[model samples]
Each structure stands twice: as structure tokens, then as C-alpha cells.
Target: MSKSGDDQVRYEPAAPKKEQGGAQKPASQKSRPLLEYSPVYLLVTIMLTLFTAEWLIMIILNMAPGIPQEWATLINALALTVVIFPVVYFFHYRPKVRDLAELKRVSLVLTESERRIRSVMEATNDSIIQINEKGLIVFWNRAAEALFGYTAKEIMNKKFLTLVTSPRYYVFFEKWFRNELDLVKKNHGDSMGQGQFEVFIKRKNEKVIPVEVSLSSVWLEDSLHTICMVRDITIRKKAFVALKESEKRFREALEKVCMVTAQVEANGKIMFCNDYFLRVTGWEKKDVLGRNLFALFIADKFHAALKKRLYESIAMRVEIKQMEQEIITRSGDCRLVMFNTTNLLDHKGRVIGVTIIGEDITERKKSEEIKKESNERLRKANEELQKAQTQLVRSEKLASLGHLAAGVAHEIRNPLNIISTSIQLLSMEERLSPETVKTSRIVMEQVKRASKITENLREFAREKKPEIIKMDLHDFLERTIALVEYEMSLENITVVRNFNSGPIYLLGDEDQLAQVFLNVIGNARDSMNEKQEEFSYDELQKRGWVGQLVIETIVNEHMAGVRFRDTGVGVTRETKEKIYDPFYTTKREGKGTGLGLAIAYGIIENHGGRIEIESDVGEGAEFSVFLPLATERNA
Candidate 1:
């Protein structure tokens, strides 16, 4: 072999380099050929040797006369093929084969390394999870199965937000990220460094555990992978919580607040309640912990409802007002309290617990209630004063009516006296003119009409005791109608009875009931005056000038009621309010004496019955009357 080992011209086996101390590369990789053993030299040497040998052999063969030229050519070809093929194939072609084997070895090493890594990941005891920057779980490992009561298959390919009772943190992240992008837009700088933050994770059971982690970005092929590493510190958290409780009383006292102290989980459960809580609930410490906050401090019927609302509020990351709520104190006192609830969130904006503050407002409520009752009594006294004033006005109007009636009566009576004496004298003469007799008779008729006016005024003034009897209300209505039927016919008013079919019972005097009916019907007729033309009334024919009047009776077991509604010209809202007062009317002075409705109102009130009137300017008027049934009245 050549000293440099390059002239050997064979593919050398891999041999470890002999070195001092430090490692060295194999000979196959580091060794190189000498200048004489170059690829070009090897090729030239073979060619030149073949050329020289062939010439010598050809010369020797020529001297053999017995050999044919074609046979000589064939023998030279065979010899050249045997020797030249072995040298060129071994030195030149075999190195290419070595290169192919080396490539396979490298590929095998890469595959083995990948397999070992995969095995370690699957075998790890602690949960090895992969999540995107959005906090969605990309992978779940066996360690996760042991820690959380979920299989890897259950969590794979799902967002980490699914296990959380409230997903507000996710929403916050999206908002924060958007804000970061906005910052990037404004400054045109990399926001990736500033945007990364740790987020708390909640388990499927609604236990929120703080985690320590960071974000990393990788370019895999042409895609980006954002990864995070998470660890559960629930035990550490509980220890920290216990320590806080040990210090809460001291802190609250130092803070100079009498507010009841409590520790609620992020999901709104009461984990620990202070001595104040036990005092309020009337229960020992055992009764407070492990109970939903809503149950301990609120009504049972709304527990399910409040739970849902609370969850939604947490999801939205909002605080709730502790409005007035009832709570059973430890002393069995159910007191009303006004409460305020605020969320306790972490640095990452994750809800850790709810903080509630409540104050008793019952005494304040009682004082306000007493003030309300006093005001109501004062209001009732004022209404009675108003009624008394109305009575005085009605009494004055009656005195005026009496004076008018006396004057009218005197004027008619003087003329009637003259006519009557004249008629008697004429009759004695036995030859009286027909006109004279007619004149006397006409004067008498006018006097009688004046007297009728006097009679109506007297009837209005009269106050009579009711005569009680079991009578059909319908018959009473009919009799009253008959009295006014002639007047109605003259006015063309149509009376409609949605009147109940009954031996409709009532306890009342016939005369008093008649008086009541007279005033009510008279008032209705007066209202129809404006609609006379519309109802086709012609005073000459005594035709249909009256509007429809509906009287409806409603009977219930405890009471018998009647509703009288009219389609006549309705009263205005202002007039309707004062319609039941004495001497209130829209009729002209000569046309009506306004005592009719006033008298009706008084009579119904004296009977312990109520009349309710509902009317608007154009919608017409309805009046309902209610009186207790006879049996109820006796009771």
C-alpha cells in the first residue's frame, strides 16, 4: 500500500482513528488519497498499461503464423475484459455504493431518536399537555388522566375553556390580544413580547387552580406553533387559603369593619364562613362550609335560578348587587338584608371567589312604613273634608231652588185666582163666550204645571227612611221606568236592558228605590239632550230623540251588582271626576236643577252600596253599583 494509503485503490473499511485523549473521526471519513492516487491518475494508468500491453501482445501473436487474425482479436478482447473491469469497478464504482449505505445509517439514527422521545412523553407521570396560544388543548397525556379525573381521549382536541365554569378569561384573552394588535398597529413594534401572560385554569369540577407558565413560538415547516406548559398548584392554593383564614379575623378587626367574613370558591360556594356567619345562620361551623352561598344566604326556591345567573355573571366577569334578601340567622332570626356581591379575580382577570357585603335594613323599612300609614290617614281625613264641603254646597243650592219654586208658584197662582173667579161668574151668566171658557181652562192648566214644578222640588228635598222587603230588582226597575216612560217616549230615548233574568233580589223600600231610579234615569236623559238630532228626535212627533241607555245586572254569590251605561253625550274627564257631587251638572239654569245626581249619590251611600262611574269625553259613561247580597248583609 502507498504510504498515504490512497494508492491502495480499494474501498477501505471504517477504522477508528488512533488518537491521544480526544476522540477522532474514522479513517473512511477523514482519510484522503495521495496525488498519484487521484481519480484522474487511476484512470490514466489503467488506460496506458492496457495500450502498452496490447501492443506487445499483438506483436507476439503476429509471429504465430498458425493463428488467424480474427482469433487473435477475440483472445485480446477476452483478456482485456477480465483484467480492466475488476480494477475500474473496485476503485471507482464501489465508493458510490458506500455513500448510499452511509445515507441509510443516518436516516435510521433519526428514526430511533424520535421513537425514544415519543415513549418518554407517553410514559411521563406528570400531565404533559400541549395547548395553543388561545389556550385550547392540543394534546393530553397519561399524567393528566391521573391528576384530573379525565382520560386523555376526553381532553384531546378541545379548548381548555370547556372545563371552566366561566369562560371570561378566554374572552379577556381575546380582548387583550386585540388590544395588543392595536398597539402593534400604532407603534409598529413586535407585541409578542408584551402580550404573553399567565392564565388560571379551572377543572371540570369548577376548581380554579393558579398555574405558572410562559408562551413560546416555533416555526414548524411553513406553519406557526404556539405552545404553553401548565402545572396544577391546587394543594399549594389550599394551604395558602388556610393560612389566609387564620389571618382573616385579625385583618378584618384591623380594617375596622363589622362585615361578616367569608371565603367563597370561584364558583360561588361557601368554603369558610366567619363567626359572624354562624351567628347569622343560627348554626355551628359545620353548617356553613360546603354549602352554596345562595342557599345559606338566600331563599331556597330561587337557588337553582340564582346559580345560573351567578354562572353567567362570572362568565361575563361582572359584579352583582346584593339587593334586599332574607337570611336565617344562627339564632333562627330571619332578617332582611341589603347585600352587595363583587368578584375576587386574579392578576390574569380570572375569578377566584366572590366577596359579599350585607347590611340589615329592617329598622329603616319599619320607620318608612309607619310614615306611609300616617300619610294615608291624613289623606282619608282630607277626603272626608271634601265631602263635607260638597254637602254644604248642595244644601245652599236646595235653598235657592226653594226660593225659585215659591216665586213661580205665586205668579201662576194670582193669575189662576182671577181666571177661576171669572169662569164662575161667566158660567152664572149662562151666556159666556167660548174663548172665555177656554181662557179660564188654559190658565188653570198653566197653574197646574207650575204646581208640578213645586212638587218635583219637594221630592228632591225629601229624605225618607227605606222600607226593607225582599223584592225583585227587575220589577222595581220596570216600575221606575214606567214613571219616566212617557218622558222617554217624548224624547225618543231607547232603553236597553242587559238586565239579568232573575227574580233578581234586593232589600229596599219601594219609595226610596223609586227615588234612586228617578235621579239616575233623569241624569241619563239629560245627557241625551246633546244627541237629540242624531237619534232622530222630533219634538212635534215625540219621536226617537233619545239615545240608548243600557242597564246591566251582574250577580255573584256574595253580592248583586248593576252596571248602568249610556251611549248619550258623555261627560268630560274633568266633569266625570265631580259627577257624584251634589248640584253638579252641565245643563242650563232654566233647563235643569242639578240636585238629581247628587241626591242619587247620597242615597246609594246611605244604603252602604257603592257606585263607580267610568267615563271619557267621547267614549260615553258607565256607572256600576254593588250591594251585598241579603244573606251577606245579615251576616
Candidate 2:
């Protein structure tokens, strides 16, 4: 009725509470006896009885001697009117009217209270419900309807426990409700006659939601009632779980990081450090916390520079990156560290501290120092070695040239002596005979032979530059193969061509490459022919030996290659090593000059190519010539 500063009014929608007893029976059953007694009819019957008694009394008086019937009747009527009417009207009828008026007033007040309660319940965000002692739902508000997905009509008169309890929570509700009822009954009208708890309620859609509930008990019409104020806590629960998970992930990340990470105050006091920082610094977290970071860890030489950087980073808000410095550890050993530092800011963007992330680079620094020293040593050693190798190569070249000159002179002298003898023989005759004419022709042949040797020597001595051109290696190999086909066939040799269809271009002197191929192919054919002479065709077939030359064209990332292989007696290791040397021929006298391979080697070298030979004593030899792939510049 009165509002106070400290007191607040709260409205709860009244619903039937679950009780130990069963559901409330209908009002008709309780009102049946009262209806039978009908007060209006009872009053009428009493008046009739009084009137009948008066009439009888008047008759008796009239029948008696010396009595007046009219007088008796009048006297009885007066008595009835005066005593009975006043008594009935004042005591019964007036009281009934007054009681009815009081009942109407109370009903109006109850209705107004209920209407206010409903308005408050609907206005509040929380779902409110009141349950009565009979376990029947007497109230369901708009908030409750929205929360539970059931309208007030649908939920009204239903048992409270039926809406909230499932089989899973039946035992829990039973115990909880028993306890709550005990409290409500024991503290019937106490100020703190309430209990709060959390439970899950299933909505009409069968969706379960967690709710925080505050309960209050009140006496309504001499019966116990329980009010529940429920709030949905799903969002709060999710946020709490997320915060806990975020904390866990933060701790895990700090533990897993490999670098040293630390936070420091602007004054260089260490505020926090991760696991790696503690381990790397050889200090416990407690030992390092609140200590001056630079004084404890940084070497003295870097103190000034680091302090300057720290000041700049915090004051100017500049980040220092990849600063290489040395820090002394607890064991008094200096470690090289590469660290980056940035200012840590507060919500207002004011610098609060600094964060330092560093990696231990001591071992790397040592390795770099060692590598630098070793590189210096290796460079000096290499220079000296190169000089010595150069001198040795020059000496060997001179010696080889001297030997070649001697061989050339000896070879030429033989032909020259033969020509001289032939000339002398022809000069002795004025009219030369047939023998003399033959001697003259022999002289001419010897001179031609000497000239041919000179020409080969000249070619060997000259250095020819390659006129580089872009050409398909396969096509070149095919053309070279055609030139040697007839020769190989004459020796009963089979030339097997293995060439990829794709074009493999190389920058080279095509003429020089052709000459190289021709020389190699000629050697292959010669080798096979020499082998054929050693074994009969049928015998060679029986031995599974065939005069075969395999020419394979191959390409790789940097070079294109052509392989020349011959199925003949391979050269010995000793002869193979010297096969590319000048004047080293295995051919019979006058059949070869031994300059073909030497020229091939020089030509390939000038074209920036490599010629590699693979051979065994019994197996055939393979010569792979690799020329660099042509580039746009070379083309």
C-alpha cells in the first residue's frame, strides 16, 4: 500500500506449485453443501413458521371463553413485527449485505493486484512464474510464454513439474523440490523464505536451455506459493568457456614458442618472460622478474646502445628490429642474440612497457667466425696451389711439345730420306728407265706424304674459334650418322640410332661438331673392323658378338649430348687415359696419324663442351659429347 525508499515492489505471476498431494479438484465439489443450504430460502421458511404459529395462537384465544381473536392476532403480529423483523433485518439480512459488499471490495483489490502483477511480469525481461501448493499452474506470463514457447492458455492449470522435469532430471527435481518445500513450510512468513538454484528447462520445441533461477516463497490464501525468476545464461556460459579456452591457448602458445620473448617496463625492469626466455637466460622466472633486464643479461658493451634503443622505442614509439648484440648469461658466458623490440601500449595508446623477442645466435656466430677463418685459409692455399699447378702444366706442355717435335721430325725424316733416295735414283739416268720412272713416282708420293703430315701438324698447332650457331643436336647426329653409315655397313657393323624426337639446340660450331662426330664414328668403325678380323662371322655370332655402333642423342637441363658407342674390344685403362693425347694412335703405321681425337678434344674444348669416355677391356667404348644448350645471346 505504501512505497518506501529502501523497499521495492516485485510482481510474480502466480502458478500452481508442485505439492506432495495431487491436483486441485474443481470448486463445484467444495461449494455443493453451501449451495444446498440457500440462506434466502431458510429466511422465508422461518418467517412462514412464525406466521403460522401466530395464527394458531389467535385461534386458540378466540375459542377460549372471554378472549378476543382480533386482539390476540393484533398483539401477536406486533410482537412478530417488532422483535423478529428487527432482529432478522439487523442481525441476518444487514450482515449479509455488508459481507457481500466487503467480498466485492476484496475481489476488486485482488483483481487490481493481479493486473499490476501481470503488467510488471510482462514488462520485465526475466521470465517469471508462480506455483501454488496444489502443483497446478495458475499463472503464465508473456515472458514465460516466450521463453518456454507455450502460451498462457496452453500452460495454465498444468502441473509445474510436468513442464520442467524430464526423466533425466526427475530425481534431482524431487530432492530439490523437497528441500525447497521444507524451507517454505518451516519459514512460512520469514523475510528470507526463498531458495535459488540453476536447472535446465526444455522448451516446446524440445530445445534445452540453461537458466539461473531465483526463487521466493509467499503465503497466498492460506497456502504456500513459490515464485521463480529465471534468466537465460547460455551467452554467459559460452563467453566464460571461451575465455577459459583463450587463456589455455595463450599459455600453450607461450610454452611452445622457440624464441625468447619477454616484457619489460620502460625502466628496463623485467615484468614477464616466456618459458624459452627463462630457459635461455638460465634463470628462473622468479629470479628474473622485477630485475633490470639490461643489468642482469645484457653485456656491458651493449648497455649504452640498448638503453638508447629502449628509450627511443618507448618514448618515440619506434620499433627496433634485428639488433645483433651479446648478452651475458647466468653462467657468465656471453651469447649472441638477435632481438627485435617494440613498445607495448595501453588502451589509451600510451607507452606502458616494451616487448623483446630474441633468438640465440651464439652457435651461429661461432660457426660464421670459423667459416670465415677457414675460407681465408682455403683461399690462400688455393692461390698457392693454382700457381704451382700452372707452373707444372707449363712444364708438362713444354715437355710434350718437345716430344711431339722429335716425333714429327723423325716421321718426316723417314719420308724425306726415301724421297732423297728416290730422287738420287732418278737423277742417275738421263733417259730414265721404267725402274727410274717408278722411283720418280715414289719420290712424288713420299713428298706428298710429308706435305700431308705437315698440314696435320699445322692444324693441330692452330687454335680455331667456334662460330657458335643454334642447331638441333639430333639433326646434326643424323647427318653425321649418314656420312658413316656406308663405312660401318661395309665392316658388317650395325648403327643403331637412338634419338629423341624433340629438338635439342646447342650453341656450337656445327662444322667442328661434325668433325668430332666423324672422327669418333670412324674410330668406332675401325675398332669393329679390327675385331671382325680376329673372329669369324659365324664364331662372332656364336659368341653373341655383333659389330654394333649405338649413337644416342640425349638432352638435360644445361647440356645436349650425343653418345658414340662401339661394340668392339675396349681400350685398356692405360691406353684410354692417353687416347686424347697428340700422336697417340693404336692404328698400324701409315693408316692413322693419331691427330683425329686430339683435334676433336681441342675443338670441343673451344666450344665449351665436354667429351667423356667410358670403356672396359672387353666391353665397347662410349664417348659422350656434351654441348651447352644454346641461349638467346649465343643464337
Candidate 3:
């Protein structure tokens, strides 16, 4: 046996030598022969001894050969066999068989142990690896293969630190291993410890992943080695990062919103509040947190009802949307607010709290109240104005009737006097005489004049809406001028038309416009004739000016205009003001019923138009008529 009582051929750790209590261990030591105590050496020695014995038997048989040669050879072979059999059986064959049986048993035990270890390692989701004393990977499991994109054969004997992406972590692992080894050695063959650490590792494809490693050490064949159970935590890390980003976004949004947002516990305690909530309630976050929501912000009068509603909504999991309530601010001032509230749920979907989003509405409520009061005032004012307008219209109507009655009585009196004088003359004649005939003719003429006056009154009183149609103003005026052409020529009046070259289309009653034009032209002719009587013919001839009537058609953005200007005795200011009044005129008796200008005014007004007269006595008059031009919508 070896002096140390250990098999010299087996691998062993070099022991540290000591010289007394404080001696340093020696570094160099002589190595022992590897095959000195092997079973193979014993077998070889036994085989050599048997071979020498057979040689000796052969020699003896040759020396004592009195028998036959063949018999001697047979005896020699038997002796060799007899001697060799026992020697080989006892010294070599038996020992070899027993050793083989032990070896097979040990092999089966080792195979079963290895199978159980592999099964355990493969069953787990975590990657399992083992590294030797030199940091070389000695074992890699199925999970390790999937995690590192490597197979056992590919990674065996490869340095484990090669998979670590960070050099700092690699150095730390080496130092930690050395420390653990030193501790284990100092502990007299005891394991240092088991521990966990995080590190980034690179896969076969050069992709980096975060992993957690649980490390354990073992003494194998007198050498210390480490076993690592690594877990890929990349997905968990991503989830954590995403959760942090989502929280950041939520906080940013809450800070930017204008409405008050807060979370309240089921007991009405404020758990969380946004910046807007603190600002609106005039309270700091420290003052609001953990305070009772109803006792702090809600008015005392609304506290009971609001609490009841909140409890009901929580129990039913219902939302209260756009509900208005009065709240008391931190300054003790009441303000109206609208609140949208809903249940705040946990991960299990169970309602544990309430979320309130509220908007301040005090100013809006005040504005609505003020608007209601203003509307009431406006309604009363409108009623008073309507009454005043009604009284004014009635007074004006009465005055207008009085003037019309007076004018009619005066106009008919002249005609009636003419008829009465003519009748008296006829009665005095007594027989068929020239004076009687002349009186009959005068009576008929006055009767015709009265009838004409009645017709003019009928036309003036009749008020009918004009039949508006699209008509060209110039063409309509030309037709009216044709009707008044003979009258203008008899009065020695010249007519001048300055018409717009472009078509001046207007939506108006053609017949009504024609009558208006004819009346205005006839007025111009009469004005000239009245002035002619005042002037001597020789003086008029010396002036070298015939009565002139100018007609013009014009077009502009909004309206079409027609102007009739005359060189004659124009009207006074008073006459111009009353010119459009019904039954008012300046013509001699029996020459006019005084309804012409008024009739023209009514017709123009019905067509959504206007008339303006500019006149001065003995200077002639100008009449301008304006009508709204036809538009796409009007057409």
C-alpha cells in the first residue's frame, strides 16, 4: 500500500505543507507513477509466471524421456495445463471476473445517477450549466441549449465567461469564484455557499439578453466547481420598462388636463389627486391626500345626498356622467360644478375605489341666469314699442282721410258748378236757341270731367301687389316713351334718352313701370306748357331753347335707375314733400285729379323700389326711379 493509504494512480489535489504553526506551503512536488498499483500490472505478472512454468515443464519432459516421445509430449502438455489453469484462475481469471462484475455494477449506478440528474435539469424551465475549476463549461442541459442557442457538444470545454457581455461582470465572476474556492479550502472541504446574481449574456447570434443566475459549488474529484441555474428574464424586463413608460404618459396627461381628476376610497377618503384637482379646490396635495372627499370639497347641504349617491353608484358599478352639484372651495366660497364619476377597479376587476372628473361651472350658471333676466326685459320693451307703433299708425290714418275728404270735395265742387251754370242757362233759353245748345255742350264736358276724377280716385285707392317679372328697363322705358311721344311733340318738348349699353335687367311689373314712366313724362310736358304761358313767344324764340325732356337709364351694383329731367318750372320744397300724397297736385282745376304722382309712388314701392324728385320753381323738375336688380336668388 502507498504510504499515504491512498491509491497513487488516482487524481488528487496537492496538499499544502506546513512547518510548524506559521510555516508557508511549498509549491513544487514530485508526481507519483500512474500505473504502479493497477490491476493490469498484476495480470501481466501472473501471465509471465505461468509462461515460465510451462517452459520449465517442457524442459523436464525432455530430460526424462524414457517413455515414448508422443506420450512425453502429452504428459508435458497436461502438466502445463494443470499448473497454468490454477495459477491463471486464482491469480488472474477469477480476479478479473470479480473486478468486471464490480465495474459493471458501478457503471450502472453512475449511469442511473447521471440520468436522474439530467432529468431533473431538463424538467426545469431554467437553464442549468456547470463549470469546472478553470471556468470551462463541463455540463450543459437542454434548457441551457435553448437559452444560449448552443448545443452541449458545441459548448463543452468552452470558457463560461465568454458568454458574459460585460467585462466587469466577467472579472467579478472570476474574483468571486476565487474567493469561494479559498473559503471552501479554508472550511476544510466544505462548500463556500449558494448565491444569485444578475448579468447580461450574449447568445450565439450576438444578441444580448438579461439573465439571473443562481450559483452553487461542489467538490468534485478533490477540485471545486460551480453549477449555475440561469433564467432568461428579457421578457420580464421589457414588461417592467413598458409599465414605467405607461405611468409616465399617464402622469403627463393628468398634468395637462383642465378638469379636476381624483381617486377616492370607498370610505370617501382622497387617495390620489391630479394637479388640476388641487388647483381647482384651492388645496395643496398634502392637504387633500387622505382627507374625506365629502367633508372637504362638497357643500354641507349636499353632503348627505352626494354620499348616498356615491355609495349607490359604487354598489351598482354605475357611472355618474355630467351631474351638477355645488361645492365649497377651500376659501369657503360655494361654486357650481359638474362631475363625471366611475368605478376604479383592481386587477381582479373588483371595484375598490371611485374616480371623479369634475369641471367648474359657476360662471356658466351666472351667465345663464343673467341671460334669462335680459330676455324678460327685452320682451316687455317689445310689447310697449308695438303699442306705440299701433297708436301712431291710427293717428296718421285719420289725418290722411281728413285731407283726402277735403281735396275730393274741392275738386268735385268746380265740376259741379260748371254743370249747374250750364243747366241754368238752358232753363232760361226756353226755346231751341244757340245759347241753349252751347249750355248743353258745357254741361256734358263738366260731366265727363267729374267722371274722369272719379276714375282717378278709384285708381289711387286700389292697392294690389304688382306682378313682378324679369324685364329690361330700357326696353320698358322705350314703350312708355312711345305712348307719350305725341304729347311731348305737341308741347314742343324734346326727349333725350341716355341709356346704358349693357342690359339693365330688373325683376319688376312691366305694365306698372310703364305707367310710372308715362306719368312722369306727362308731368314734364305739363310743367313746360305752364311755363310757356308765362313767357312771350317772341322772348321764347329769342331764348332759342325748346322745352327739353331727358330720359336716362343706368345700371349699378345693386339697383337699376331711370331719370326723367325737364327744362320747365320746377316745384317748391312744400310741393315736393306732398307730391307723392294721394289726391294732391298743383295742376289747374279739371286738368288733374292730383292722384298721378301718388299712384306712381305706390307702384314703385310695391316693386321694392323708390322715387326721388328734385325740383325748383320755373327751373323744371327731375324724377329718379330706382329698382332692385334681378339676382340669381331673386330669379
TM-score ranking, high to low:
1, 2, 3
Clashes of 3: 4
Clashing pairs in 2: 15-130, 15-131, 15-138, 16-131, 16-132, 16-136, 16-138, 17-131, 17-132, 17-135
Scored by CA lDDT, what does every candidate get?
A: 0.64, 0.76, 0.79
lDDT of 2 at 471: 86
**TM-score for each predicted model, relative to the true structure:** 0.52, 0.37, 0.34
Model 3, position 359: C-alpha lDDT score: 89
TM-score of 1: 0.52
Instruction: Give the TM-score (vs. native) of candidate 2.
Output: 0.37
Instruction: For candidate 1, give the lDDT.
Output: 0.64
Specify the highest-lDDT model's number: 3
Question: Which residue pairs clash within candidate 3?
Answer: 568-620, 569-618, 570-618, 570-620
Model 2 RMSD vs true structure: 21.5
Candidate 1 regions exceeding 4 Å error are 1-256, 260-263, 266-268, 272-276, 284-287, 294-299, 346-348, 396-455, 461-474, 478-508, 525-561, 567-569, 577-584, 587-595, 599-612, 624-635
**Per-residue lDDT of 509-552 in model 3, one digit per residue for the tens?**
87788888888888888888888888965688788757889989
Which 10-residue window of candidate 3 scores lowest in summed lDDT? Answer: 1-10
Q: Top TM-score: which candidate number?
A: 1
